[model samples]
Structure formats: C-alpha cells, structure tokens
Target: MTASRSDALFENLLESAQRLSFDSRSPQLYELESGDDERHGMTPEWSPLYGTPLWNSLTEQERARLTRNEVAQFLGVGIWLEVGLQVALLRAGHSADPSRPDIKFLFNECADENMHSLMFVGAIEAIGAKFYQRDRALDFFGWIFRHFVWDEVAYGVVLAGEEIFDVMQRDWMTDEDVAAPIRRAAYIHVVEESRHMAFARRKIRDRLVGLSRIRRAVSTLIIAIGTHLIAKGMINRRVYEDLGLDWEVVRANIDGNEHHRMMFRRAAEPFIEFLSKEGLLNFGARWIYRKSNLL
Candidate 1:
C-alpha cells in the first residue's frame, strides 16, 4: 500500500514483461512480413502484411487529419491506458510469483502496440501528415494514472479494451466495405490479439483471482480508472474534425446527450456479455463495462 511497494511492483512487472522482447517469434516478425501490401495485395487479406502502405500517400490535409486520429487512437487512448496497465501489472508481480510466460506475452503485446502506433504514424507520413498534441483530448482521462493502481483492476481494464479492440478488428476483417488501410490494421491486430486475449483470460482466471485482498482492492480501483478512460475515448472525433464539423456538434451526433455514452457502451457490449456469460464478471470487470455505460 505504501508508495515504495507500489513503485517496486511496477518495476518488477516491467522487468518480467521485458522478457518477451528477446523472444524469437514476436508479432514484430509478422509486421516485417507485411511488406508493400498497400501497393499490391500480394498477401492474404488476413495477413498482418495485408495493407501496409509505403511512405508516399499523404497530402498535407490528409496527413493532418490522419495524425489527429493517430494521436487519439494510439497515444491518447491506447498507449496511456492499455499499455500502461501492463506496466502496472508487471510492477505488481514483484512481490508475488508472476507468470513468466504471461509477462512475456504482455511484453510482446506492448511491442505490438508500439509498432501499431508507429504503423499509424507511418501511414500518416506516407500521406504526408503532421500532428499537434494540443488537438488531442488531453483532459479526458488525466485522472486514471494520478495514483497507484492494483493489478486485477489493471488487468480487467486491459482485458475489456482488448475485447473491444479484438471485436473491432474481427469486424474489419469480415467487412467488405472496410478500406484497405483499415483492413491491414485489423489483420495485424487480430494476429496479435488472438494470443493476447487468450493470455488475458488465463492471467485473470489463474493469476489475478489468487492475489491477496489488498491486491484485489487495488485491482478494483485500477479497473474503475481504466473503465472511465475507455469511455472517454470512444467518440468519433477526428473524422468530424476532418470534415470541418464543430467538435461539440460531432459529439452531439455521435453521442446525443443521454445517448452521448452509447459509442463506448456499444463498442464494449460484446466483451461485457462475454465476461458475464463466462462467469468472469468480477467487480473490476463490471466496473469497466459500467464505466463504458455498457451494463
């Protein structure tokens, strides 16, 4: 409960997770194989390399809009909340016997996430885009990382996001109307998340459930913070901004007043349902869904 304990927990978790970086077969390999799919569809649609663009497509306007979306999608929403949870969990494992495979899997996942951010930025650059941090929704979930958080809560928050993201990627793979660029993104994610989600379910079931009471309490608080962060990130803003729509007006259209919370809920709904049906719906899990206004 002390700050020192918390800091130590984070450090250990990160160290364990870092083990994956040295693993021979990482999602990074899949990314490397994804060469020039944007220019030619030589790879299968399900391949992680299916639609990777070269660095030459963006005009100034297009790049700017893409950069905004990238900041919102990767940095603001994904990295700060999702990857941050992994770091928190790694730290928590310091005092306990953390699963090496799980930590490694998570580390690999972090690598994938980092690559995804790079890929998004690369796509923007291919089209010639630049981004300004000021345009990001900075205050949206600034409260989540203000204090130490527990592992269970952190895991649940991460699991919920993964579930939502996985579902989105699956949909994109199946959608006939999805653009090539989006499909490429989906392909890479699906390949990685297939393992990540499986790992999450096991980690939560086996590892998280066995933690001490103090850890459980911390987990709950972390999950709550994660839930709120996710809820705030679901609005489709950059598209509207690209079209010169007022931010408020776009929010109104996407999340009309009481219905303003719908986007996050709808996106997270399948995960909520899955957890409930699987009997994995802990307070932390439910808290995440509720924060998204899904349950």
Candidate 2:
C-alpha cells in the first residue's frame, strides 16, 4: 500500500474511534430481561456439541448453562488476546514516532482494547459464568508473540483472532436467543473491531510488500500455529467438567462434530481467503489450518 493510502486509513480509523467509542460501564448496556434465563449465552449452533446425541439429550436449562460457560470461555480467551495485542501495540509505539497517524491510531486501538477487555470481564460476570483456567502453553506462546513478532506476522495473527471472533459475534449480537449481556457486548465488540481488523489487514498487506520468500514462509507458519492455538484455546475441556459432563466424551463429540467443524470453517473462511490472496497460505500453513478445523 502507498503511504498516502495508509495514512488515509489511519486517519479514518482514528476519526471513527473518536466518534463511535463507548463506555463499557453504561448501565443500559447490561440491562437484563425477565426471561434471560431462557436465552443461550451464545448461538447454540456454534457450540462444539451441537447436533450430537448428548446435546439433544440436555434440557433447555442444561443447554443454556453449557452455552453460558462456552461463551464465557470465548470471552475469557478474547480478553487474553486483546491484552496481548495491546502489549504488542505499546511495544511498537515505544520507538515509533508519536506524530505519525498510524502511531496515534495504535494508541487509540490500545484504549479500545482495554475497554473491550473490561466489557468481556463484565459480560462474563453478568452471566454468572466462570472463566476458564489458563493454558500455560498458550500463555507462553502469547508472550513470545507479543514480544517478538512484528509487521505482517504480528498483524496477520491479530487479524486471524479478530476475524474469527468477528464472525461469531456478528451472529451472537443479532441472535435474539443469545443472552442480553453477551449480545450487548458482542455488539460493542463487532463495531469497534471492524476498525481494528481493517488496520491489521492494511498493515499485513503493506508489510508483506518486499518480504523475502524465506521470511514469508516462516511468518506464514508462525501465524498458522498461532491461529491453531487460538482455535484450540477458545474452548477449555474444563468447561465440560464444570458442567458435569465427561470431558473425554465431549472431546470425542467435538472431534467428530461435522457441524462444529463447519462452523469453524465458516468463521475462518474470510481470513483464509485473505491470507491465500496474500500468499501466506503455503503447504505447511494449510496443513496447520486443516488440523485446526478452520480450513
């Protein structure tokens, strides 16, 4: 991308951030309805166990409870990703010229991410759902990524997470069957993250302009691995145990879940297409994505 085009993108993103920002503490955002207990915490079809015999056997209340924990797991992972992104942005900003429009936008994005984390935390609390335990391996990978990854690789990984969540949140925000708090949070996230995704895409495209073939291949593999970890980390096996279900059975069901696999592909399709067009989906990356069930 040209410098002029990049500058314009940042300027427009910054303008939107100024005009459309929201306070996560707004009481209206957390308003609950009388029958909220009847609602799913996420779209039921997105559940890993959806269409399985176990899922069919559950009472509506039981299913709702499971979905509540499932969505909370997603929100919890989102918060973790947002925090890592913020750290990466701040580190990038350290040596960057503050006068640059992109740097300004970076700081603005950090502020937005902070609010998003707060919104996720509040939503998890509102639904009376517990957060999943941290995966130490993923946490270590996040640490390495935030501190070391840069340019196309960094932005590509960020875009993958944002895009996957964006697809799901678009569904959750509009689904009347979803919980009120989750819907409200999803709405806010979808609105703000549109700008973030645009910025990441532009950065990835620009950064890849003259990258060496070897570097591009390495970056592609790293991004694919990061995406795989993110896909796996979104749902904790503990969610099943906490809900009084057998983790092995749930894992088996998820592994065999054509519906769940289809949902993953649907959520990831846009990013996969974008990556392919950018020449980031080499043989190795494609294999990783397939294993993640996101191809």
Per TM-score, the best of the predicted structures is 2
- In model 1, which runs have C-alpha deviations exceeding 4 angstroms? 1-76, 93-99, 127-147, 174-176, 208-222, 236-242, 257-266, 277-291
> TM-score for every candidate vs. truth?
0.59, 0.98
- Model 1 lDDT tens row, 1-295: 3334434544554554454323223334224223322232111232211122311233434433433343334323554554466566656655554444444445566776676655544543333233324324434343444346544455666777777666556755555443345445556666665555665565565555456767655555555555655655544455346645566744443333343244346657776665565455567756665655667
lDDT of 1: 0.50
Q: Each candidate's lDDT (Cα)?
A: 0.50, 0.91
**Model 2 CA lDDT for position 85:** 83
| Clashing residue pairs for model 2 | none
